[model samples]
Target: MQYNYNISRITLNDDSHQLIGEILFPTINNDIVLLEHVFINPTFEQQGFGSLLVAEFVKHAIHQKLTVKLLDPFAKLEFAKHPEYQQLLINE
Candidate 1:
């Protein structure tokens, strides 16, 4: 089975200003941002594009004083394996 939902995409570019990768997120409530899909094109995968996308999202969230909830597969794993992530989950 598959589930579909709307995502707002944000893209970043290179020095030449060419688009490289995109991050997709869903807005929840009026004060939360739920990151749903994050992809760094195969060609840009290991170059921190994913982190950059996350950082951008964080910046927006901070500006709006919104809580950020990343509901991706790795978020669960990180929650399970990292104390910091677990604390974040608990704090929210």
Candidate 2:
């Protein structure tokens, strides 16, 4: 089997495409965009793809002027190590 992976923004009603991974942010009244979940297909984990996906999401959040609120800090710590992500860190 072969797998191709990419990052995409998906809503609850939209499921036409197969998702290798996803980061979900629930709608709420706040300046912070909560990263509710981050998932990668097992076949794709630990190969740097997760970080790339996170970086993409971070870019999206920053563009919307929302701070990223990571619910699972440990899941994101790997991606946060990249220097470009320093500004997005929320003090815990």
Candidate 3:
């Protein structure tokens, strides 16, 4: 199955045709983004949509050179799994 994996500075959506999940990373400062929430439709949970959202968000953060001040537990877990994304964290 192919998920849309949409990405933007403030949001990540799971699909181009449907909204299966989302990640909210709002800017907190010139160089920081606060990862406020990650919401995957309950029906879509545990199917990797959330992880794709985080991965795309992290990539965008890296590309934009914005550090992530993680508030979302879901994002924290995803971020913890990848070493490449460590430098993108604000407090790590």
- TM-scores for all candidates: the values are 0.64, 0.63, 0.80
Considering every candidate listed, which one attains the maximal TM-score?
3
TM-score, model 3 to reference = 0.80
Model 2 has an lDDT value of 0.58
Off by over 4 Å in 3: 1-16
Local distance difference test values of all predictions, in order: 0.58, 0.58, 0.74
User: Which of the predicted structures, 2 or 3, would earn the higher TM-score when compared with the native?
Assistant: 3
Instruction: Rank all candidate structures by their lDDT, best first, as comma-separated numbers.
Output: 3, 2, 1
Report RMSD (Å) for each prediction in the order shown: 7.5, 5.9, 3.2
User: 2 or 3, which is superior by lDDT?
Assistant: 3
Relative to the true structure, candidate 1 has a C-alpha RMSD (angstroms) of: 7.5
Deviating ranges (above 4 Å) for candidate 2: 1-17, 89-92
Q: lDDT by residue for model 3 over 1-92, one digit each (tens)?
A: 33343333333344454567777776777878798898887878888878888887877777778887988898888888988888887765
Tens digit of per-residue lDDT, candidate 2, span 1-92: 22232332422211444455666766444655567777776756676656666766777767776666667564468555777765765555
Which pairs, if any, clash in model 2? none
